[model samples]
Target: MIVFFLAIAILITIKIIWVLCATSGQGSFDREKKEIIRRANYLTSMVCTSPQGLLDEMPSGIGEQFQGEWALYTCSMTSAALANIAILYPPNKELSIKFIDQIIDIAMSEEIREYDKLRWREDPMDGIYGNLSHISYYSHLAWMISRYKQIGGDGKYDDLYHSLCKAMNRRIRKSKSLNLPTYPGEYIYIPDMLVAIVALANYSSQYEGKYSTTVDMWVERAKKEWIDKETGLVASFLEAYNDSVQIVLPVKGSYSALNCYYLSLVDSEFAKEQYDCLMKNYKQGFPFAGLKEYHDRTCLFGMDIDAGPIIFNLSPSGTAFTIGCAASLDDMEFRNKLLKTAEIGGSTVTWFGKSHYLLANLALVGEAIVLAMRTSAPQTRMRNK
Candidate 1:
C-alpha cells in the first residue's frame, strides 16, 4: 500500500511538472533556434548520403530489419528531415537543394531500378504490402514534390514523381479486391493507408482538378477502413486474409503521432478524431514517468531505430517521431507536452552549457509554431485598398 501510494505521488508530481513546463508562455526555447539548425544539420548529415546521394541505413541496434527491400525507410526519414530543415531555415536553400538532388539521384539508381524490376517477387501482393518501407519511400517522394518544388533539379524529377504516382495507382487498380483501392492484395492497414492518402493528396495538389477525385476517394477509404469508431484512434491494420477486415485494438503511441501528422495535410474529420483520441488516451507514465516500452495487450513494445529506444516501458523513438508529427500538426498543447516529456526523458542533452535535444525540438517546434501563427494571423488591409 505504501509503494502504491508513492507511485501515485510520483505520477502526480511528474504531471504537474509537465503542465508547468508546457504552459510557460515566454517561449523560452525560441532563442536557441540557431543551435537547433546546426544540430539538425549535423544529424541529417550523419544519417543520410553516400557518395552517390542515396540515404544509408542507420545502424539498427533495435530489432528493425534494414537488409530487406526495406532500404527505402532511410529515404522517408530524409524526406521528413529535409522538409523540417526547409521549414526552419529557408535561407539555407543550397543545402536543401543538395539533399533533394541526392534523394532523386538515389531513386533513379541501379539499386532502385533493380528493385522495381523484381517488385513482383519481392513485394507483397495485398494492398497492405510494403508496410513502413514502401510508405516511407512514397511519402518522402510526395513531400519533396509538394513542399520543396522550388528546389527542382531537372525535368526528370517531375517525370519520376508522375511515374511513382502512376505505379501506385496501377498497384491499387490491380488489387481489385476492395471497392476502394487496397494496398497490394487485401491488406488495408493503417500505416499503408496513411502513406497512400498523403501520397495521393500531394500528387493531386500538383495536378489540382485533374486528380482531386482520386485523392478524395483515397482519403475516404482511409476514414472507413483504419479508424476505430469506439476508441477514436486509428488501428494498425486490417488483415487481408481474414473474412472481414480485422481491426487491431489499442491505439499505438507512434501511430497516434503519425496519424495526426498525416491528417493535418488533408484536414479530414478523421484527423480531428485521432487527435482527440490521442489526448484522451495519453498516460503520464512511461518515459516521462519511468517505463521504456509502450506495451499493452494488443501491441508489443520493442526497440527499433524508427520506434526509438524503448525505455522503462515506453518507446522513445515512437514518442520522438510522434512529437514531430504533433508539432507539424500545430497542436500546441500536445507539442508542449511532448517538449516537456523530452526534457524529462533525457532527449535534450546538455553539452558545454548548450542543450542538444531542446535545440532540435525547438527547430521543429518553431516551424510548427510559425506555420500556425501565419495561418491564424489576422489579415491586414492596405490603406489604398
Candidate 2:
C-alpha cells in the first residue's frame, strides 16, 4: 500500500510539472501543434466510426430528439475545434480541413437535422432566405464554414454561408429585441445569438461590410439590454414577446463566459470588459481555479446538461469556455492557471498517439471543446481580416 501510494504521488507531481512546462509559452507551439493533431485524429476516427453515437450510457428516459441535439453538438463542436487546429498549425491544414468537412457534413445531414425538422416540420435549410429560428444550428454551421474559408478551404459552401448570414441578419434586423430564437418559438439564448453575430461579422469582413451594419447594431443594443447589472455579465435566457424582452435565467456563468468568447471574435474591447467582469464576479480560486455556475457562491446550483456538473461551486462549462476567452484576450496568466486546473481535473490519457479525457462521459465532446478553447489565439481570425 505504501509503495502504491508513493507511485501515485510521483505520477501526480510529474503531471503538475508537465502542465507547468506546457503552459510556459516558450517553445510550446510545436508541442501544442502535435497535441492538436493527436486529439483531432481521435475525434476524426470516433466520429467516422459512429457519427451519431450517443454517450456510452445515456439514460433510457432521454428521447431521440435530445439524442439528436447532443449528436449535433458533438459534430459541430468537433468540426470547429479541428478548424481551429487547421488555422493554428498550418501543416495540419489539409487533413484538418478534410476532417472538418466530413464532420460538418454529418452535422448538416438529415440524421442530425431530424430534431429540427421534427420541431418545425421542415428542413432547416429549406427556409434559408426566411426567418429560420434555428440559430444554434445555423450559427455553428456558418461559423464552421467561416473558419473553413479562413484556412483556404475550397468555396463549395460559399452560397450556403452567404444564405445563412443573410437569413440571420434579416431576422435580427426585423426583431424588436434584436435577437432570434434558438428554436422556432423558444426564447433566445444570448450565446447562440452572439454566435450568429460572429458568423455575420466574419462574413462581413470577407465581403464588403454587407452585414456589418446589422452586426454592429445588435452589439450596440445588446450592450445596453443584454447585460445583467447585478453580475454585469450577459444573461443566459431571455424571452421576446409582446414587443418586450423578459429576462428568464439571469447571471449564468456558463453562458456569460461563452458569450465573451464569441464576442472576442468581433469586438475585443467589449469582450475584454465582460471577461474582466466574469473574472471579478465568478472566478473561484480554491477546489480548482474555475468559474462558479452562478454569481452567488452561497446559492446552490446543481448539474444541468448545458452547464455540466457543478461541484464545490465550480462549473465545468464555465471553466472550460473561459479557457478560450482568456486565450482570445491574451490573458496568459489566467489561461495558464485554467489549463493547469483542467490538467489536474480532466483525467487526460494519451494512448496510441491519441488523447482523450477518461473522466468525461462525453469524452469526444469534452476533448473537442478543450482543443478549440485552448487554441483560441487571436490569429485565428485577425490574420484572415
Candidate 3:
C-alpha cells in the first residue's frame, strides 16, 4: 500500500498549491471591490450635491415656508453625502474640507435661520414646523463636523461644535420629563434624542479630558433608561408620569439605526446585547420569523423613506446600516449576511436608478463599509495609566 500512500500525498500537495494560488489572488479581488465601492460613492455624491448646486430656481420666503423645508432637506442630503465621502475616502482630504465648509455655510445661511424659528409653530403648507427644535439639523451638522475633525478638520469648526453641543444640551434639559427627555413630542417622528446622543458622543470624544463628567452623565443615563432590558433594544420614546419613566411600545427601524449610534458611544458589551437581540427577533427567518415580510405590523413592518423600501423580507435600512457597524466590530457573520442583503436589495432599483432612491441608502451603505474597514484596521489606543 506504499503506492496508495504516495498517491494521497501527491493529491495533498496539489491541494496546497491550489490554496496558495487562491490566497495570492485575493489582492486582485479586494482591489475590484474597492473600485466598485469607489464608483458607487462617486455616483451617490453627485446625486446628493448636484441638485442643489445646479438649481436655478431658489424658493422665496422666510419662516415656515415651503422653500425653507426644501432647503433643509437639501442641506441635510448634502451633509450626509459629504460625511459618507469623507469616511470612505480619507485621501480626498481637500474635498472633505470643502464640503464641511459648504455644510456650515448652508446651515448658517439666512434661509435656515428663518426656518429654525418656524420649527415651533405651524406653517401654511408644511403644517407644524420646528418640531425637531434645531436638534436634528445640528446633529447632522455635528456628525459632519466630527467626521471632518476625525479626518483632520481640526480647529476649523471648534466654535461651531461647541455652540451645537450647548444648544443641544439646553434643549435636552428643557425637554426632560421625569429625568428622561421627551423628543419631538407629537409633530415630528424623528428620534431627536438619539441624534443628540450621537452628537454629544462625538463632542465628548473630541474634548474628553475637559468634559469627562458631562459626557459620562449623559452616556450613563442613555444606557440605563433608553435601552430596553427585555429586548436589549432602545425604544423610540419614554412616557413621563408621576416621576416614573415608562418605555414606549413598537420599536422600529429608525430606532434600530439609533441603537447602532448609541452602541458606538458605549463598550462592546452593550453592542453585543443589541446584536444578539436583533439577530434573534428582528432578522428574517429567526425566532421572529416573517417580520421582514409584514408591511402593516408597526413594530416590525418597514417602508419609510428613512428606512428605505423593505423588500423580500428584509429591512433595507436596518440591515444595510447595521452591517457596516457590525463589520467594524468584527462581527463577521452579521456583516457578511448584511452585505449580502444589501447586494440583493441594492440591485432591485429600476425607477430613478440609484439616484432616485433616498440619499440615506447610499450614504448608509458607504458609511457601513468604511466603518467595517476601520474596525478591521489596527490602531493604537491612547489610555491614561
- Top candidate on TM-score is 2
Q: Model 1 over residues 1-385: C-alpha lDDT tens digits?
A: 9999999999989867765653353232354355455545544553345522332332333222332223444444454455545554556556766766665455445454334234333432232234222443454455555545533334556765775666565555444322222223544446545665567666775676545565576566656775667656666556654334566555566666566666666654556567666655643443363212233432344464334555555655455555545554555455555556655654344344333444333233322222222121111110111
State how far residue 219 of model 2 sits from its true place (Å): 0.4
Which parts of model 2 have CA positions greater than 4 angstroms off?
1-28, 53-62, 299-301, 360-363, 379-385
Alpha-carbon lDDT of model 2 = 0.77
| Candidate 2 per-residue C-alpha lDDT over 5-46 given as tens digits, one digit per residue, 9 for 90 to 100 | 999999989988876654554233455666667777777777
> What TM-scores do the predictions have?
0.67, 0.89, 0.65
The TM-score obtained by model 2 is 0.89
The 0-to-1 C-alpha lDDT of every candidate, in the order given, reads 0.49, 0.77, 0.49
**Model 1, residue 220: C-alpha shift (Å):** 1.7
Candidate 1 stretches with Cα past 4 Å from truth are 1-32, 51-57, 60-71, 107-139, 150-154, 173-188, 241-244, 283-309, 343-385
Better of 1 and 3 by TM-score: 1
When 2 and 3 are scored with lDDT, the better candidate is 2
RMSD of each: 7.9, 3.2, 10.9
lDDT assessment of candidate 1: 0.49
